[model samples]
Structures are given as structure tokens and as C-alpha cells.
Target: MPPPEPGDVINYIYLFAHEAAAGRDEGVKERPVLVIASDAMGVAVVPITTKGEARSSRSDRIPDPVARAMGLPRAGESHVVVNDVNDFDWRGHDVIDLKTGSFLYGRCPPTYFQKIVRAVQASAALITDRR
Candidate 1:
């Protein structure tokens, strides 16, 4: 499958700890990520976690309705870790099935997706000011 577009919610294998240590990421299970960009090389994404209490200034909570519309599991609340965005090579990674947890792509409504974009834009503005 092709890489998901920006604002798309996709299931991916995100081994963040490994990526930090070994300059590579290898995951054993599928995880949720919000695609920020997609190119021939791969996708730029930010990890989304279901741990609601983990929210901070760097993250934005995903509305429940939007989460369900995106086909995310009926887990607890979810949030996009906007500050931890990274680029992943599309060597063998892409979208995944939302229902059966199979390999396919999934997407959310544009209205809610805009919320994430605004959050990221705000974060980026702060970074620019800091620099």
C-alpha cells in the first residue's frame, strides 16, 4: 500500500527506543501514528498514544468521535505526540487494516485532522521563535 497522507491515522511499527539507541526502529506490534507527510522516500509521522494522562504541551488529544471514525480500536483516549515527529523509510512499511489489524491504510475526517495540523503548526511556531 502507498504511504498515508498528512492528517491520516495509520497503524505502524514504532520502536522509538530502538530508533534512539541504534539509529533504527524495529517494532514487534502495530502502533498508531499520524502522518505529517508522505513522499517517495517514506512518511513523516508522529506517534499517537492512547495514554490520556501522558498529555503535555507537546501533544494534542484526539477527539473521541474522530478516533472512532478513523477506525482506531475502542481503546481509551488518544493523543498525537507532536513533538516527536520522525521520518520513516517506506522500505516495507505502509498503512495497515483498521478492522482486522491487517496491513492496509486508514484515514480520519478532515475536520478533526485540521485540529492536529493546527497543533503542529503552533508547536513549530514556538520552535521557530526559540531559534
Candidate 2:
């Protein structure tokens, strides 16, 4: 049970985001979202403080990091499917973002869905060592 490598932890940002977007738009496979890599790019620094770490940052902070890190546009502006890229999709757990509730991604009371999404995300790690 070693700690997740930087890349695995890094992708968690997208995993949560993709989960949120999926719930927001259940019918669509692609959904744009924002991210923040803790401004550690180019410095050769593996910051352990990405937005996904504390889940305290505002969801609005997403685009800045994604744009800076992956050259991706802000969420809602461009379309990216969670499964299409290296991102996660329908991992079985429903996703819930309390912070984004009714503010950025347009939702609420994430407690209900949070556990579901978490379970799904957790189950996703079953077959692959991606977790």
C-alpha cells in the first residue's frame, strides 16, 4: 500500500471532474471541466497540492490549471470525454462535488451523490493498477 504516484494522484483531479461532468450531463460522454496543477508547471516540481488534494478550492479555479498544464480550454468551452482521453469514466461510483454544488458545475448537497461516485471511482481501481 504505497502512496499513489504523482501521475495517479494528478489524474484524480480529472477523475473527480469527469465524474461531476457525467452527472451534470448524463446523456453526454464529453464534458469540459477546469483544473489547477498548483502552479508547479515547468519548475520541475511535483507539487502535492493540486486542487484535488484538499477539495477546498473553488471549482471556478479549474480552467486556469488545465490551460496552463495541458493547454486545454476552460470547462464548458471545449468538449472532452472522460473516457476519450486518459481520464476516467463510469467507474461505477457516482461523483459528487460539494464545492461545485450550485455554483460552478451547477448542482447541491453532494453528500448523497458523493459516496456513490466515490464508490464507483474506487471500484474502477479493481481491474487496473491505475488507482
Candidate 3:
């Protein structure tokens, strides 16, 4: 499969801040992440979780329509935690394959991606740099 581009939603083992602070080197489980940026250096992604409330300042809710478009399950709402982004090499070891011949769940629409970018920029989210 080709390298993931910005706007792609892919399953990843995203190590959270608390986990890292506790000396845990890995995430607890695989979860979806939004590929906010990708370049020669690596990719920057924000974790998508079902944990945030709507209109939360630290997170941007993924609309049901958009989530469906991205092939996410219809189980519940997902939010992009804009305040915590993870940076790592493209196709890094933390990436997980969903047994679909690719790591990608699907791509977010351009407009929605732009909205996410705006939200991230507006927040004081910490960008955790990792290999």
C-alpha cells in the first residue's frame, strides 16, 4: 500500500502522555487516528476517541456523516483530541493493520480536514515527538 497522506484515518497504537509519563512504551490498544500532516520527516496524527463531550475545547467531534464516510463504525461518536498530537515516522511500528490490506480506515473529506487543522491550530495542544 502507498504511504498514508494527511486526512487519512488509520488504526494506530497511540501512546498517551500519561502512559509515557508512567514509563509505558506502548499504547493499551489500537485506535483510530487522524493523519493531520505527513512529510519526509514523518507524520503527525491526533488520536480519535469516543471519550470527549461534544464541543469540548480540546477536541473536535467527528460528525456522524463524516465518520461514516471515513468507514468508522456507527457505534458512537468519535472526537479528535486536538490538544495531543503524536509525531512519528511514516508507516512506523505503532501503525496497525486492520486486515484490510491497509492501515487506513478511510480519508476524511478535505473540508473536514481543514476544520480539524483550524481546531488544532487554535488549541495549545502538545505535539509529542517520537520515533
Candidate 4:
């Protein structure tokens, strides 16, 4: 199997977030979710490469410097660390990250790659069971 494009990752994560939001009556039908542990525990399936080489071909989100300059404060003072596309343009197999602790992937602290992987893996079970 081949790897997923960055946009696919973003879109799927968005899809999972929408599903989870509707499930919780959170009125968040159209946006990235700020999953809180205190609320219903939901895992978001996301993709992550261990290196910074594949981003060169990715055409997703714009540069962070520009985003910050444009006053893009994350929801409720939250933040995300995006690696340079130039640096991560074609890296390794995507790894699922954990969601409850600190994570440092290639100098970027995403903190939830493995958890997303586990969540997605669990979801994949239904497909497996059908086999």
C-alpha cells in the first residue's frame, strides 16, 4: 500500500472530528476538535511521518509564520506545532501517536500520533471482522 497525502490526513481527521462532535452535541460540525479528556473520550485518527522530508510535496496549510502574523490564535489559547513542509516532504511510514502525554516527533511536539493510530486501528476492526 502507498502512503496518504497530507490533505487526506487532514480531511480524515476533520471527518472523525465531525463525527465525534455530533455524537457529543458539541455544536462543532465544522472545525478541528479540541478533544478534552474531561469530556467524552474520543480518539481522532491522524497520520504522522517520523521525518521531515515528505512535506516538500504537501500543499496543505500555509506557513505558520504567516499564520501567526495574521493573528491565528488556536482555539482557547491552544497551539499546534507544524513542521516545515520542506523538511518533512517525503518521510517514513505514518505512525499513530498517543494522546495523553508529551510527544516529540522530529523536533515537533504533536503529542497524539500514536493515539490516533490506535483509534483508527480499532475502527479498522469492523472491516477486518467483515472478512
Higher-TM-score candidate of 1 and 2: 1
Taking all chains together, the TM-score of candidate 4 against the true structure is: 0.20
**TM-score winner among the candidates?**
3
Residue pairs with clashing backbones, model 1: 95-104, 96-104, 97-102, 97-104
RMSD vs true structure, all candidates:
5.5, 15.5, 2.5, 16.2
The 10-residue segment of model 2 with minimum total lDDT is: 36-45
lDDT scores in order: 0.62, 0.26, 0.82, 0.25
lDDT of 4 by residue, 2-120 (tens): 33322222211122222333463222122222211111222222222222223221112324543233233332232322221111112212223224231111211133433333343
Better of 1 and 3 by lDDT: 3
Candidate 4, superposed: residue stretches over 4 Å from native: 1-110, 125-131
lDDT (tens digit, per residue) of candidate 3 on 1-131: 34588999999999776566679888888899899888876899988888784233378778888988887864257888887788898668999889887788998999999999998888877777778
TM-score of each: 0.70, 0.19, 0.88, 0.20
For model 3, what is the error of residue 54's alpha carbon versus the real structure, in angstroms, after optimal superposition? 12
After superposition, which runs of candidate 1 have C-alpha atoms over 4 Å from their true positions?
17-29, 53-57, 93-101, 124-131
Give one clash count per candidate, in the order shown. Answer: 4, 9, 0, 18
User: Residue 65 of candidate 2: its Cα lDDT?
Assistant: 38
lDDT of 4 at 105: 19
Model 2: residues >4 Å from true position, as ranges?
1-27, 32-60, 63-66, 75-131
